[model samples]
Target: MESAIKWTSNETVLGFGKDAIAFLDTKLFSKKSPCDKKMYEILIIEPFYGGSHKVLIDMLYKALEDEYSDSKICMVTMTAKKWHWRARTSALYLSQVIPKQHAFRVMFSSSVLNLGDLIALRNDLADVKKIVYFHENQLVYPVREKKDRDFQYGYNEIVTSMVADTVVFNSEFNRETFLKSIKAFFKVQPDFRPKGLEGEIRQKTRVLYFPVMYDVGSHSKDYESTLHIVWPHRWEHDKAPEDFMKVLRKLSEAHCDFTVSMVGEQFTDVSKAFKEAETSLFPHIRHWGFLPSRREYLDLLSRAHVAVSTAKHEFFGVAMMEAAFNKCLPLCPKRLVYPEIYPNECLYNDSEDLFTRLAAFSRNVSAIKEVVADVKLDFSKYSAVNLLPHYVSLFK
Candidate 1:
């Protein structure tokens, strides 16, 4: 029997519309096949299906197929844009499309959707055992100094936790901070605060690290005398591209002999800092913007010597791990998810420390290589081969 659902190019962009409903109804309900040999079916809901979330979902899907060969996986997703609209609306579309007759044994959802909102619709999901996976939560999400936090999004996560049979966070930091923030949020509520909700949610929450889907290889050949630094993170504010550029500026002032590759997904609204870097740091840049092909991205990682992250917010560092697997030594901030993933030698105390480390690295690339050569990152815990069994047990 065929193992996966082959989706057309256009089918992925189908949103909450008449055309989407019609297409989903036909694709899901009208199909009758001799290949229907699965023992059970699982439905996956990922409203923001792009970047890291998309990568994680794809890995999970592949793992599920490998672990449970006789199971079917159905997905309902949307592009990663207009997130507020996606969160409030995607559930309604899913409720309308997933047939009542289809006995889905389990429904796995990402934090992007509010499962409580879906349950309120009183759809086919009523009897289905639901699991909510938190890629990141809005409660602990950092915002710009002048901007106000969206309480609605955080509240939705809390409600979804209440609705789900089990809640899983990608990191212990994410789980603890979110649970702590819930208490803080309730304290400020005017009236009718739900008591012991945090405790209830905490009891069911488990920390499962995100899987890294890449093969570890021998370190890349030394690029003679060049120091190739790569920033493999989204071009956004939370990633703190401005800070990365500042480091480059300092390097340029000191006349450091090195090259940089600013490689990651660039959304419609890219940081102005990157635009400025294009002119000021153009001489030092090797590759810029997103590489459409995964082969090309991996190739870039293979050639790079160091991977750096100056993120203000990171629940889990997926890109960093990917680069490390490709033999790039990581130099990241000592806070957020970095400290947990990397050893003390791989981290810097602050941005100034990071700049100092980079400057020293530029002068002597061999020293950096020597340090990295001695350390071995235990990536097995996040590998699909090791983590798939746990997922299978959870799904069962």
Candidate 2:
């Protein structure tokens, strides 16, 4: 049987033959009425939809849907594993699945989609404005080993940026690093190099912080007398769970009166450090692994007095922001996105510095509480309500 699917310059026609047309009517490609056309529909493509990435897009969707009565949103997402494969193939799947009748004014996608490839193939989507949001770019992403490094993912991001009408990054650091890395990538290219593509992409780029929904209740007022520390980050190599375990070990050696909640999602390839910590620091652990529910997670966060981070790479610190919103005193490394989000007092220079601060916090809980109480940190900027206008303006 001949395939009924046929690609045209303006539209993709499914079941195109005369016999197939009787089964599949023109309703597939027909335009909407004037009243229906008044509505602005957006198609969001997030290939890696898990963890922080999922949380971010979900929040954005909710904000837009609730706030703008005239706007409509549709999502096409994939699981967050084998990211390279996802980036390579998601667009092909999306093009086939998304209905032709749905007239999307804008197509919002993450860096996970090879936008250049997608846009080039889907002539029907040519008229639709494309906006690419970078939660994390492969250009500056860290690899555990040199041999595991593949430049194709980074190249895909570069192509994605070039094809996008506008590009948004979650942090200034992320934007700057991506821009700089692309320049270096160009320098290393063998021949027939493209000039000014980075600059062109940069000109269209904008920095917008991830919108955090403030759900932390007033329960934070009741801080436990005992020092309760929380490490709410994924148990992965990039998060550097070993450093966190080392801090716990130092606290244990000092015989500090503290309890730790080692909470975060665990993947198949478990970090050996976590196993070591499980055995060694079992006594101090109050809660371990991913919390059962959001309520339970927030309750744990509220009860805790300090939130710590020992990440080796972070484009944006959403976990840290959530902890801070819950009134947990942040004690993070001075590198990555921490310096931009946290005050100098909250940052530690080295592992020894982190150990000293953790020990001090445990010994003098009152001091840290005072710091948390006195610090008038404004998290309003990260609020979805505040960021919605900026997002809406992008469609203009």
| lDDT digits (tens) for residues 233-299 of candidate 2 | 8887778988888878988998988889988976446667678888898889889888746667777
CA RMSD per model (angstroms): 7.3, 10.0
Worst lDDT 10-window in candidate 2: 1-10
Model 2 residue 42 distance off true place after TM-score fit, in angstroms: 1.9
Candidate 2 achieves a global lDDT of 0.74
- Residue 288 displacement (Å), model 1: 0.2
What are the models' TM-scores?
A: 0.87, 0.84
Q: Model 1, 100-174: lDDT tens per residue?
A: 556678988898888988888855677888999998888877776414777788889999999999999988888
Q: Candidate 2 versus the native: TM-score?
A: 0.84
| Best model number under lDDT | 1
Off by over 4 Å in 1: 1-40, 67-71, 145-147, 216-219
